[model samples]
Target: MPPIVLTIPEAVTASKMSRTAIYNALKDGTLCARKSGRRTLIPTGELQRYIDALPPYTGKV
Candidate 1:
């Protein structure tokens, strides 16, 4: 089966970011998205790439 594109709410849930943060990232070119008519969509692969590109987290000692 084919993967599904995510809507803003879906992306928020998947990325665990606030709506404002997602919009900011989109505005800053950190996250990629495409418009289909009036709906904004993020490809599953693109979201995965963004997550994969993030640096690893290290907790404070």
Candidate 2:
């Protein structure tokens, strides 16, 4: 079958998050993910949603 999902690495690249950051986001419930067997798969739609909804980043508070 064709590829219908984006993997963790792809999601990280798209999300511009590091591995630890992604895991942290997942833990914090800010980012969403799924497990397929032994691999983590992130839905492109949801990734986009998160990206679009992310708050603007500044140098500091």
Candidate 3:
């Protein structure tokens, strides 16, 4: 079974995004994160939703 939540590094891998991007999203409020003591977790569903909501590729250079 897949994980219910992912660490920041896992989120970066799953989303194929840079760690900075993920942090930026969290800082900018585009992405939501949960606190587990000193750890930060992102729900898999939320990550998928964020990916799905991204603008479709137009093949522009």
Candidate 4:
């Protein structure tokens, strides 16, 4: 089973997004995360939910 949460760097890799983009999403309330001491973790389920909520994509041009 996948871990319940992912570190920022791990989330970036898993989401295929830049660190800035992740931070922007977090700041804008588009994504959710939890602070564990000094580390911020994004829940795997939240990540999946975010992806699931995105509009359907067309094929690459």
lDDT of each model, Cα atoms only? 0.88, 0.78, 0.93, 0.91
Q: Count the backbone clashes (under 3 Å) in each candidate.
A: 0, 0, 0, 0
Candidate 1 lDDT score at position 38:
96
Cα lDDT tens digits, model 1, 1-61, are 7557999999999889799988988898988999999999999888888888887888855
Per-candidate TM-scores read: 0.82, 0.71, 0.92, 0.84
Ranking of predictions according to TM-score: 3, 4, 1, 2
Q: What's the CA error at residue 53 for candidate 1, in Å?
A: 1.3
Backbone clash pairs for candidate 1 read none
lDDT of 2 by residue, 1-61 (tens): 6356788888777768788877777788877888989998877777778778878898797
How much is the lDDT of residue 5 in candidate 2? 70
- Native-to-model Cα distance after best TM-score fit, residue 17 in candidate 3, in Å: 0.5
Pairs clashing within candidate 3: none
Clashes of 1: 0
Best by TM-score, which number?
3
Clashing pairs in 2: none
The best candidate in terms of lDDT = 3
Better of 1 and 2 by lDDT: 1
